[model samples]
Target: MLRGIVEQEGISKEKLEARQAQIQEEASKRFFESASQKASSLETMTLKSPALKSRRRVLDDYDSIALERILGTSDLFPISYLQIGLNAGQSICRIQIRDARGRSLGYGTGFLVADNILMTNNHVLDSLETALDSIAEFNYQDDENFMPCPTHTFRLDPEQFFITDKDLDFTLVAVKDNPSSEKQPTDFGHLQLIPTAGKILEGEYVSIIQHPKGGPKSVTVRENKVSSIFDDFIHYLTDTEPGSSGSPVFNDQWVVVALHHSGVPDPNKKNAWVGNEGIRISAISTYISENYVSYSATEQRILTKVFPNLKPGPSSSSQADGYDKSFLGSNYIVELPKLSEEMENDVSRMEDNNYVLDYTHFSIVMCRSRCLAYFTAVNIDGNQAVNIKRSGDSWKFDPRIPESVQYGNDLYAKNDLDRGHLVRRLDPVWGDKAQQANDDTFVFTNSSPQHKNLNQKIWLDLENYIMQNAINHNLKVTVFTGPVFRSDDMVYRGKFRIPAEFWKVAVMVRDDGKISATAYLQTQKNMIDNLEFAYGEYKTYQVPVTSIEDITGLDFGNLYLHDPIKDRETIGHVIVAPEHIKL
Candidate 1:
């Protein structure tokens, strides 16, 4: 009976053990499932942030194989062509096109190519079509009589396309024969296409010829880098716009590599066209070859005209293989020669756009963005003064002189009417040290409106006089000058600053009583001529140094002036030098 009881207990124990094992398996599976779901949730949360993910994908996509493969060849190298603004008196050709409808539309500009063919984006033609279909009147700025009509017959490349799927948007058209005696075709010449034979390394310099969407269409040249490549397409993180579509992409060699397609426009940002992609020309080389078989003569002619200087096929790579610290993103580059030791030394002390000692005039000035203003930097003169002279009716303090005015809490010119410094602030001083401050000094606030002619002529004389006089006499002069805004109640960073009724400048001297100054009224470009004819007398007058204080209402009482004076140094003070001492 005892043995039977033992056996029954052992079986019950075994059954309980099996139930616990099953429960443990269920718990393990549930834990793993919960962990995976949580991981998925975290990923979804991360994708919710657009700013973080937008640029992130571009960088990552560059690592993919498809992008790497396409940009890896010498056949896919980039080329760039330069563009000059039309306003600068550059030579250009206007192309007019008409579609099935007879209505007129806007015209397009043809970039110079070597062959007889002219090049423009396909969309330009489409816009011409829409205009013709609408029977709209074409508006032109330069030639009012010029109307939109198909002046040149052309053929669109069958190889070109508007891609929606794996879209590589580009349209290549052939140039037609033009009659002689017409406006010379703007055939700057053709550029060699970049080859795609080698790997396009990251951060490579790339440029594009883009058309900006605006009143008059223009070809804008911009440069950037190959941020990433993906699925047979390379993405450029360049600034492009809607009208830039179907433009050409080139590398440093000035060769055409890809056809510009589309971009991601940042609606919230101005002038922001991001993610411009291009159709890899190498990918469709066969199509280009097959379609142009019938137009071989035309293709050859176009090629010859576009690139008279080039032989088709892969060209030598002028592109630098490694990092170039000297190169910036390719939009603009400074190519100024190195400065002299003296200029370099002084520039180091000032901010970018900050004025250095005007050796011509004994004063300092700041180059605020668009405007340039003068500051006082005077010193004591020890020698006895002579050659005191005057030219006007009488040496009197004229408070009404425009130079006597002040603006934005800064008193610039006290008696001098001529706007003094131009090209203020030495950019070289800051090289790389706190560039923003250097840039900020260029603000137009630091500048005053000055007559361009006067700046180049009479003002130039005054500047030279100051520089020569200071150097010759060993005189230390102080100069303070700025602009006079229209409003008396002006704001410097939102706080109100009072200004004088008219603009003027004041120069104080340490030498025996001789004061040399000029003053005049401020006027716009149109009114400058009239103001000059009226106030031109002020430009020739020479007033006493003591008269400056009375006119400007500024007291520099008992202060010794020096160009570079040590602390606690005293130059004896006396009344303004007599009329004879003023030079």
Candidate 2:
């Protein structure tokens, strides 16, 4: 199958030889370095072994010992080895690759590397579409009585999490949970890929569990020997067929050492195989660590679960600090919006009477009764802004607050509602701490349940226009955003009320050093009420800061004076475009 792929790709023999030579050179370098380290350890042990034991005296007579007794225990393994190997085998699965129409492409081996995460060769499930079409079949082998065991199939969810490297020949993708199945992926524990070296030495016996030729599960236990070690790969003498790609190469203790990927052809003989090569687990771990920050919030969360040590530094918000009221600048002071006297007790607050949940460059004030934020405030430094891409969504509850007081995935699951970011993700994502700010926006405290169309269209456009205006002019802007909670708001799932109207107040300093504050309101009430309908349109209107305060029961202090629409006799000015904004 590998040969067929190579032929189809039109890879020349010269190219293969050059790649082989490069691998060999790297292997040789790694071998010598490892050899030196082993020699040093051996020397130290040789020097210390004698001192640790008593001095040997010349024996007058030697007891006769049977050769069978010595040989019997020399290479013997403990009874637990079989049990450990059997448990590890459960994680191994046959990957059935298929096209869009469900036609069989081929098969490869894969194993669970983390909860709901499967590891396989990139060639087997190369792209997101391929993974979507493929399925992981567990317990595809016969039982002890030679009868076929019931198999469980799971679909790959690359949309949730997927990271692959072609050169490394490894791919990690999320597997959809199958709770109704007789056997769950969690039943078979995952193999943690340790990054440290010294799991096995060259010439040591290794083992491989694979689905060869897409056949039943099989194990070549302790028959394969590690022949060479490289910085990123290892060559081992093993009986691996085409379908063995992505198999886990294990040490005697069942610890995964490498990911089996390809075979090395015998140079002197035609159509003959010498040994197989695998990407070292340590190398894969290094690759993941280096590129972790580039992944989306969902990917990062999954990776952090797999590798706990890879979690980023603690969030600045976790320290109980509030928003920097003077973040815009010392000269331009924009204080935090104040809640009305009757609404003050409805918010969560600290011992200092501060009701803000501070993050990297933003803050939030949670509404206890609504289980969502009353408002979010952020300081945007357009000059220092970073162009971070939105890959995936993974919202988490803030640890400082009670989880019960937060509306999480349950509120938006299996619905058209979207978890809208109150403080736009890209707004606070600026300066040196951009990534932290990006992650900070994913908390449930900073999100509200919004209709899909409203969140994706005009509402989103208005946010982009405001943010882009600040960036284009290199101006610093402080924005306050929140949902307008109403007593008549619709109760969702009988748990919490979903806000129909949302509002934003953007404050910026003009060239003349005068403060310019603008307020806008958008409602998805029609969409929320008519969710069964295929389509519903939302309206966005520019309003006075005082008007927003009246509905939200919040005081913007002197921001009302800076509002350009404060003197308008009418309530709202319907905005159709950027030119329609009353700045």
Candidate 3:
């Protein structure tokens, strides 16, 4: 009983009962007072309670039709893409000219057609006919095993030969049956042979067949339209490359039209297909019909199936003679578009061979003049076309910079990467001016070895900033940023090379009464550095954009401008006091 009372039951029943009653009474009084106060406060309350809300528009900005089109289009179009010297099945052929004794004469692939008789360029047949009296030989085969050159040779009938055509590319030969000793000629299906006289309309779809080096060996087809046509020649806008020569061009029906011809000797711009041209079939068809013998049953059957109901088409687009205006100040330079992927790959391979260096894409103009320098993720199109060298006591785009040295001073520097440009050279233009923009564009200090992602994103933003803010205001700016040190081979070096992916962007702006500079050295993924190195603080170093441009002889008027910073200010210039450099 005593323990129960001690355990909160009250020492004694009477006292415990009294204490509990007293506590209950006091609690009720306090509760009533508190309730009254809360009611009064609620009646007098003014501020509203917080609530969730959303904007009215959600799907307004989207284009349903465009989205559907992109998602629904069929993929049949990419099949027809072709390059030169390649065959209809996207394979290359080996022209084997040999004697009856199986002695070899010459070897090459088919190129352009001269007349009705099949014609490979003269260069292809040169070795076979080196000595006219040397028994004429002919052997032909296709690229089956990806070998650089074919081994075995079969004799070609001397009677198969006709005098090669002049002016136009033409070769006449009698069709012959396969020897009992060898496998039958590889069938490339039927080749669509369209006459040049066929309706050559501007903007009409066309296809090509050829084997491209380093790509597919089977016949590949691609489609494109005629950008423009000339009286002397026709220029279509389809993408083509080396080894595509001798490839056939056709209409949608797969009827052969023309032969893939040549490309610009050298290219420096991006996506480097400097526009593909082909040989007109009309120029050589008459000669082929008159001199070459008829195809065998097999050949005839193939042709009939491939070119059913083939007929002459008209010159659809009017001749583009009167419209051939000057691209820039009477310089007869052909206005080739940016480089194509195949061309870029070729240049990259060539650069690996030490034949040239390429850093062609436009980059930021960080700092110019005597002490000019900049950065980018990759130096593009530098030496792929024109020879590039480091200007003495000056700065310009140089293709020979080793990858290591090119992207040094940053943790992410390496080889085989692009040093992209934040600002484009063509963005700035005085007026309706069209030129190479080389003096302004071909500067090295405006680059930074970049990854494909950030280069296309943040770098593009930086370009937009300069273009909208600076150039529009007539304020000239120059920027410079690039990767660290690495190899010099543009192609090989790009494979394993690291990137000073750390973009150290520095911009110099020249405005009224002042010069300004600002910089941002950061990454897209990690806001901070992973290792022990403290993130290099962004430092804007500037003197004057014009002063530097004057010293360097670069024209910055054509550079796009963008100035959206909070306050216009100057970056540090190399201001050595008169006596600062002296003893």
Candidate 4:
């Protein structure tokens, strides 16, 4: 009976222990299954979290090789805000395209590349003729009160010197200076054009300041990365709107890298995109280098200053289109040098179909850009010297140029300067058109800003001395007078340049059939600051014909060798009075 009880007890204990072990195993398995499900849910949430992943992964489908490579470069060299001070608020101008009826066509943006030159898109400016009719408004921004700021408006130059390229879709034009003020494009500053290749790389930051959708100036900066670079175009994410057509696309350094043109879809399929395409600036530089000859030397100098790497354009003489030398008459002692290369469309034609050059005794060899030379027929014998003149005879603008371009009375107001005529009123006052020629002498283009002293004292004496010779010789003489227009002349009021020197070339037919030439040069530098005509302050030199030709860029037709001063060591003599002058 005792042995049976012990065996039963052992078997019961073993059964209890086995049951507990099985329960523990079942609990352990349930706990693990519950934990695994929670862990799986957490993993799913983390995989979808943007903050926890790499930026590359966040961009997801934008991982194409081009974008990937670009992003990689951007990733390595982080975009930085470098400059905001240099040329920040001075370069931009608001443009309005109008029709012949003064009707609004559209609005766009433009910036200065050189002094007096504004650049925009051809699509914005259609044709060269359209640009001349358009207006450029500067300081077109709102003040703190949300009121439109006071703006300066200027019309385009009548020179109508336009160079456009459809491939680049660019229009470069010359804007007129402020007619009433001494303000110039240089006062506003300009963007430095960089033509060196590889200066702009893909994945660099580009910040654009523009007048978007024809609205006030706005700037776009965030996420504005250069996505890709084609041969001539750059695709960026710079967020530009419609009216931003010609706004300069600036890099982080504020240097213009391209011109904002068109935009495309974003790579992420985010349904968020804008016009972000630009014609690379390098391409524009190429066009400029080829077409620079059409511009004036002053214009070219500005371009060269802005772009040191620029090459010279093809060589061409001054072009004066749609006009001939007949205005001066072929009966002269010799024909004036033909403006074969630098010919510009005649200002009369450029102005209107009804506008006539209507030249009388004097003619203008108008350089399409600069009216470089003026010629007048002088009849010493068959002429009446009309003294019909008034101190109040207003300086009228040349109808040939738009109001914005004419060098009118604004430059002389309150300044002791005189509007000296290239073709003196007396010289051309002999024929039936005496009054007309006298009236024409007042045209701003025909006159330069002369020091009152020099114009009254020295310059007048020289003209009188020459006219006196007309009586000694025949009534026939031809005179050509103008400024020696240098690219870097001293600026007045920041816009007009008072030429330091004036030159005159007078031709006469001697008693013998031989042609005699005399060249005169007068400088007014010492008298510039003096309001009075101080004696001994002016120097009038009877320079060699070679010197005159050298300074005026005029070919005198073998007259340099025939000058009285041709063989002198000193090309000229300083003449204070008529007696001091050598005819």
Candidate 5:
């Protein structure tokens, strides 16, 4: 149960205004104090001998010149400026979010900083599931003479990649490549991330081209300036509106410096706006650098561009990446199911892996026995694009996980068992990096041994049916799957141990915010016991989701109450067919 809101003493409007004014005054005083010190030093130097004073003035001029070089000159609209805006426009995108009926829900903005990767505010796109129906329109602007601009549209790729941080108010996603056309290419002429801090200075002129109120793109070329820089935020005097939530805040060189999120009221009594608050690009780079794993050379190169200092190896934990369980709608952590004390013994929870794979829709926890807990998502996109084709990437042990803990190919040799995907190969294949996701499913940690019939027939169909039919349940579904380890498991030629039964618990978030879940168990008892060279007979059952909690000792986080068979007395006995699913 949620606790009531904490009540604090409220201050009068006058007191609130006074406190805000004081804060502004203090900040202004600090800036001026430094300026005053510089002025005093210059005055003191001027009082010296003429030659020495002139020498001091020369040094000051040199300092000004150096500052100009770093911040870029405001003296003239240089040729570089035109190229900057042009390239930025190609990268900038207008985000339009809509509801189920195709009516407009709202709009925001975003920009591509690297290949197929776009950055925006978390509030704009809380998750790829929500972003599925949201359209990302590129080059949605007016021409030089205010003529209609050519544009391209790309869908959000939830299956490929998605990561977001709420404290930073930023979301990074990989969008589909644009098709071949006269309008645009797959690549958006992107801006390289600022390599480090001090790239954007306070009071420096910053540019922002955005679709305000979902209108055509408008640029704040001459009107915007960086007001302040905080640990995670950059306050800038950029003109924005309701539809500009995720617009990129760029420096004069067209380098993306921040993501404009919300406007703040001025402290003065004029009742005017001061500046907008934005999540710093550095914060974004740091988060993505630490949390998300790159799949291919292209993604690796882009990751290097966005996070130049990122090391080659994987991070220790998402917590090491400044993880907050509450952020991203508590997407990071997979809560252990509510189980009795007897269920807690001997269960080891694992999350860290070589993939840096704790993302919006999925995370993997491999046990010491080589099998894993795979948490994956199914949403509206998953329902449509469930047909993502597979590639022939060779299965390999993930370097980040202990090599000894994985079931390698040696286990399948000279046996009736088949190497199966615990997370299901088709489940993660959605979005821009669909190929990469397909490749990821081939990792050894995600594989288990299954009877050929179980892999090809009942088990496969059970998952396929749920993913397809659960479309009615809002498509924002999360699933957990793994093999159930028992002491009497089959020993494969003394090299590997294969379990007879495997379990899957699928939790779907209904349109009304309630969870709907179904637990399934598949066993190959008949096939493995026969010891004959024939196809195995497999049985798949729909068990109560709570039953898994007792056996796995992991919590499913409010998903138990949602089990369709939770209240049924015949649970674990009543079998469900694809057409007869309770969904």
Candidate 6:
């Protein structure tokens, strides 16, 4: 295959030979430099060591023993190394490359690079059509008792994301979501490809996890020595077969170093292999970053997940002065809702008498008495929205407010309660400041304690529907969300009050230039009990904007006039599906 690629590219034999020699020399220089650094460090350590004042034994073998102590004879690894390697091997899968008719074309190896994203050789999955037709079979190996393990198959979703480079011989595509599968793709954790160098040094051993000859998953453990290094490729003396094309070449720490693609044939002999070559992970990352502009927002978002280092961090100049009223445009101005005099007295305010707390793309007005946001407002630009993956739940307290007032992890630590985001994490995530906007949503000020069942089901679905609506129409939307605080709300943990009902109001300008405001209400009143969530049916409703204002004692200016359901006699319409949504 290497010869075939060389011939197809019309590369002269002389050029290949010269390139090989240059890479070999570079590898040798790197190895020597590394060795010199190690020796220098050892010498410094010896000079700093305390002198042995009382040496009782002075034997002939003492000098050799001391030398051995300074310079280690063998490489040592921890007992956990095997366990880590085994865990990493689970991500490896056999790729069954087939045609549209389900006829087998061939087979190769691939692995999860991110959640629902697989990485393989470009030659194995050359085009979008090829990837779409292929399927990834996980757990395609024998069990501990040498019995065949049940495999989980997942189809590739090239329509969602697909990128490849013929020169790099690498392809990255998304795997279709398989919620009903016995094992999820996320169950076998991904091998994050770090863009930085120094993962492995020259002359170090690399392990290849592969499915050789279209067979069960196998690993050649630390047997391949890196022989040469180039700008975009590395040569290793690794034993691999035809079906090992897309195997992940890993270092001792189970970090992926390269993507094994083809073998380097022995020049002196025919039908013999000298070493295997892999595309450097760093090179692939660089290529993707450089060509990021060509991809769609969805693809770019996925790329950012696969290469998090490429995602831009929050800018130092990013100053948020609360949600913008004119974010929808000059013609359509949606001012902040006015707080009633009685509600205003209980609202948390700064020294300047400003109640709105500024974040990246959102603002919050906390209720001083309830210790929860009276309302949170966010500006959503659907076109520029970046889908930043949630790293973890790290709810924090806003430093501007007293920590004693805001609820932390205590309320949701042991119960079925969820710290639901008032301003959804993905709402304000757009433009160059997406990551910062995402981080800003994690503050405790923006969260409300709700039943897990309510937060994860209809409420989440409604949020997705709203976002998708904005995206589909290529419009900007301003959203206001908060709990419907009532005097009779259930009290939990002796001090904190858990609101049973949550409401969201979204305002957007239609393509026809008319402003549209819609309100939604979800209740968990029956679900929340004394200290736990009892089984109960949770319902979401499309309500009139006037109803929200009446319940919360807040004036939303002229938003009620633009309500899609305001003219209707119904106060609340049950939203069972996406079609049930008014706007």
Question: Tens-digit lDDT track for model 3 on 70-160?
Answer: 1223334323233322344322233443333445443323422211123443323322232121221122334456554332223333243
Candidate 1 local lDDT, 1-583, one digit each (tens): 0000111221222442343344324423433344334321112333344432432332323333423322332323222112322221122234343344442233343333333333344344332222223211111223434444323233322222111111222333433333442432333334444223222433455666443442333443335666554434555666655444445665443345555555644445754544556555554342333222112222334433433433232211111111121222132221212223433433312223323432211233332221223233322121222222221111111011122222321322332233333322321112222222222222223334444444455444544454445546755433333333333333323432323222233233435544333332222333243433523422322333233334433333432132122132332122121221223
Q: Please give the lDDT score at residue 56 for candidate 1.
A: 35
> Deviation in angstroms for 293 in model 6?
30
Q: Candidate 3: RMSD over Cα atoms? A: 35.5
Q: Between candidates 1 and 4, name the one with more favorable TM-score.
A: 4
TM-scores, all models, native as reference: 0.28, 0.53, 0.29, 0.41, 0.47, 0.47
Evaluation by lDDT, superior candidate among 2 and 3: 2
Error of 3 at 8 (Å): 99
Worst 10 residues of 1 by lDDT: 1-10
The global Cα lDDT (0 to 1) of model 5 is: 0.61
* TM-score quality measure for candidate 4: 0.41
Candidate 1 TM-score, C-alpha based:
0.28
Q: Is candidate 2 or candidate 3 better by TM-score?
A: 2
Q: How many Å off is the CA of 262 in candidate 4?
A: 2.2
What would the per-residue lDDT of candidate 4 be over residues 22-135, giving only the tens digit for each residue?
433442343334433432111233333442233233232533442333334344322223235225546788788776667665678899887777877766664655676688
Candidate 3 runs further than 4 Å off: 1-92, 96-108, 111-117, 126-155, 175-182, 186-196, 213-220, 237-239, 266-273, 286-583
lDDT tens digits by residue: candidate 5, 22-132: 434543443333433432221233234443333233122423443343334435555656875877687888888754455566778888866677777766766555566
Instruction: Please give, for residues 481-574, the per-residue lDDT of candidate 2 as tens digits.
Output: 9999898998877776889999999999888878889999999888888555636667999999989989998889989898888888999888
Task: Write out the backbone clash pairs for model 2.
Answer: none
- Write candidate 6's Cα lDDT for 1-583 as tens digits: 0101212232233432344445434444444444334422222333333321111121124234433322334465656768878989988999998877787767889999889999998777767767778899999999889999999999998777787776777888888867779788888889888875545545567899999989999989878567666668777888988789899998766778899887655556876776777888878887775554334335556777888777332222123645999899888888889999998998877656777887777889999998999899999998998988987676666645666778888888889889999999999999877876787787789899988889899999999998998788777999999999898998787888999999999999877789889999999988986445388777999999999998898899999899988999988899889889877
Prediction-by-prediction clash tally: 83, 0, 131, 16, 6, 0
Candidates ranked, most accurate by lDDT first: 6, 2, 5, 4, 3, 1
